[model samples]
Target: MNKFDAIVIGAGQAGVPLAKKLAAAGWKTALIEKRAIGGTCINDGCTPTKTMIASARMAYMAGRSDELGIHIPEYRVDFKAIMDRKSTIVKQFREGATKGLEETKNLTVIYGTARFVDPHTLYVDKNDGSFENYTAKKIFINTGCTPFIPDIDGLKEIPYLTSTTLLEIKEVPEHLLIIGAGYIGLEFAQLFRRLGSQVTIVEKSNRLMPKEDDDICTVMSDIFDQDGIRVWTETQVESLSLKLGKVHVKLDGGGKGPASLNCSHVLVASGRTPQTAALGLENTGVVCDEKGFIKVNKRLQTAEQHIYALGDVKGGPAFTHISYNDHLVITENLLNGRHKDISKRMIPYCMFTDPQLGRVGMNESQAKEAGIDYLVASIPMKNVARAIESAETRGLMKAIIDKKSRRILGAAIIGEQGGEIMTVLQMAMMGKITADEIRSGIFAHPLYSESLNNLFMSV
Candidate 1:
């Protein structure tokens, strides 16, 4: 048995940084990873998906070039090239993350599956077919999540793709049927449609984005419709089977959709489930919720105070940036003698569709549900000078403001460069800047930022 000062299972965004920092602070550390370094974000999730989205965006823009007075004879999407580039970028990022850990002093990188033997002890089944046991004074579990496979009948017999497996397709799908209409499903729906696939989205929810405000969902639904993607809401996928070299899907509910459909490929993007069951948590005091997410406090500490849980495994915001922030909170509280609680931290996220959906803080519905007296201000992209000039005017900008305080509460930007534009608003909210201040603020002409001045004018 080997003993260390700290041990971090799963080398994700949170685990990597936390292990490095702990080792740098003079505590011996061990980071055990079952697969490649960098976890899902680098190996499969964010990095590869965003890279392919960029390629899809290029194809989409080329197809729309006629509106910009540019006559392009022909353009084709080289699916192999796109996949190659995604693999290349993923490899680069994974290599970089691995190198960072390799260079860290007093930190041992173990490639294996770790299971808890006790609160402070773990046994690792190494990739080399050897067994090893390590115990630490402190343990951190950053094991991330995996695509949740639903229990639809006949699903196991047929070959279906997941978000991870979808990236490895040899050729563009002829017709892709995606399950779920959350951000993951919607993004793939648009990207595959752009890649010359007949894409259809089936969502169990009544609206496309149930969490978003109605106006936002309406605009997104309209945009998807305009893009020639069929959307079926309040729909259930009863069963799936392979027939005549095509995937036959049985549909129920959502009266408008056909009772049966055929597609070349099926993507199961329903949701994500945590990778905690295999960790043998029953051996320790750490508790997991019914959904298998590790229960943690505001400080990210598990019931076993010396053991901490971070990243998607701990639930809450599952974005990569949030996981990185988890590392910051844990490191500051432990190494720097500072108490930083993430319960009140502002979270910003972006959905990379044709026109990105950027969101920060609460939306109108959330504000109302929380009983906060808030006022709303909004402007369409068609009204923004920059959007008009770019010929990419499609979505809108909306802000929720505190009624009496005049402070910007939350914002959503769904347009070209929406993520970048939303960042400006997030900074304003962080500073407690008022709506009047933003309305009267002078912004450079014909930029997306200028739209902020107009967005807040209504308030």
Candidate 2:
């Protein structure tokens, strides 16, 4: 049996950095990964999708260049070229991450699938068909989640795409049908529609992005309508079958939509399932929730005190940033002897659509559910000088403020560069800057941030 001071299973965003830091702090570490060094973010999720989205955004803008007074005769999306670019960037990122792990002192990079044999022991089935048992004083589980495959009839017989496989298509889909309307489905819906595919979204929720406020969803719906992307809400996919070369999808529950549709491709983007099932947690004292996510305390420690769970495996927020932050919390609390609590952090996320939806803190629904007295401020993108000047006025910005404290509770931006604008507001919220200061703040003219002045003025 091989032994180490520490072992990190899954070389994901959290595992890579945590292993490096632990090794740098003088602990011998083993970083075991079943696949590529970078986890979903670099291999499948954020990096590749964002790269393709960038190409799609470029194609979208080139198609409308005439409106910008830059008349272009024509523009075409070379699907292979876009895929190649995405592949190139993904490879670059993976190579960099691999290099970082391999060069780190006292960190051994292992290629294998690891499962707990006990609280401090793991058995690895190496990729080379070899096996090894490892014991460490401390263990960290950073294994991320995978796309959830829903249980629809005839789904197994027909070929369907998940978020991971959708990126590997040989050609652009003729008609792309997506199963969910959350962040993943919406981003891909806009992405393929801009990439010249006939796109349709069938969501089980009553409306698109049910978590967002009604007005935000309305603006997003309007944007999708303008892009010619069809959306059916409160719908469920009953079954799927292959008819000729096309996939016949039978959907139900939409009030006024066709019972079924035939599409060249079907993407099941419903949600993700935690990657803890195969971790052999049953052999250890560590506990998992009903969803198979490892249960961890605020310090990210599992019930087995020496074992820690980080990132999507622990199951609060699934964003890449959240995973990286998990690493920071563990590193600080463990290495630096600081008592950093993971629960004290704010969660910020951005949906990378044409009009990006960036959110931080609480929204109106959460405030109402919590019974907090709140005031709202909102403005359309058409009212923003920068958005109108750029001819991309398709969404709005909304903010929720505490009525008693006059402080910004939460904010949402659904305009161009919405993520960046949302970060500025997040900083203000972090600093406890009151709504009055934001309303009267001097922001540069004709920029998206300046709209915050207009947004908060009405509050």
Candidate 3:
């Protein structure tokens, strides 16, 4: 039996930072990970996908260079080279993470799956034949989540890919059928479409990304339609089958009755669920919600006060940045005994399609649903000088301001560097900058951000 001051169940974004902090604070820590060091971000989620997305974006720009007055007669995409580049960068990041863990004093990195025998006792099933039992005063489960596989007929029997599996694909799929139209689906749909694949997206909801405002969703649908991508919303996938080496997908509902489609590959991007079933939390008396998420308070503490849950495992916003923020909260609690709550934090996220959607604070729909007194203002990218000069005018910038406070409530950007432009609004909201300041603010000429001057002026 082994004992440590702290035991972090997963070496994820939250676990890594928390473990380092615990070790630095003179606590003997055990960081247990069943897989590679970097967890979801470096291995499958952010790093590899973004790197491939970059390659796809460059290919798209080269193909459309005629509009920019730089005509390249032909541009060929080497799918293998793109995959290799992704692999190289992923390797570098994983090695760097591994090095950091090694350098952490009093941090014992273990390769194993940990299950709670009791609240304080953990039985570690190591990769090797040897097994160990560990007890700690403080335990954290940052195991995060996995891509949820929806129960469609004949799904498991066929070679369908998840978001993680699709990243490892070397060949550009001849035809890719995505099962969901959320952020994961849209990003891959655009990336593969740009990589010369015939991409079709099917969403179960009535519209694509129903979480966004109706207008924003409509604009995204139009942009994809213009880009030669087929989108079918209010669609339900009935079953999947293999026909002559192609994936034959039978989808029901939508505008069409029952429909059958054939594709070279099928990628499922429905959603993800917390990874807690195998953690043996049942024996620990820690309660998990109906969706399998470990129930954590605003301070990220579980039913067992000594044990904490962070990141997607606690089932709120599932993003790398959110997990990092979870680390900050947990570290502060452990170090200064402070209760820095994450429930009220301003969460910002971006979807990296061609016309990236950068969002911070409340969208129009949310403010309306909450019955908040808000004012909305918008500016089309076509109205911006930089957008016209760059010939990338396709989306819009929208802001929602609280009427009473005259402060920015939320803003959404769907243009080139949409996330980058949204950050300006996020800072304004953070600093309590009023809507009037943004309206009258003098911004530099000929930049997409300068559209802020016009966006708020119209409000």
The candidate that achieves the highest lDDT relative to the unseen native structure: 1
TM-score of 3: 0.98
Q: Rate the local accuracy (lDDT) of all candidates.
A: 0.94, 0.93, 0.91
Question: lDDT at 59 for candidate 1?
Answer: 92
Candidate 1, run of 10 with poorest lDDT: 252-261
Clashes of each: 0, 0, 0
Off by over 4 Å in 1: 254-258
- Compose the digit string of candidate 3's lDDT tens values, residues 68-119: 8898999899999999999999999999988999999999999988899999
Error of 2 at 153 (Å): 0.6
RMSD of each: 0.9, 1.0, 1.0
- Candidate order by lDDT, highest to lowest? 1, 2, 3
Task: Identify the runs in model 2 with alpha carbons over 4 angstroms from their true place.
Answer: 254-258
Give the clashing residue pairs of candidate 1, or none.
none
For residue 114, what is the lDDT in candidate 3? 88
lDDT of 2 by residue, 246-282 (tens): 9998889767665988999889999999999899999
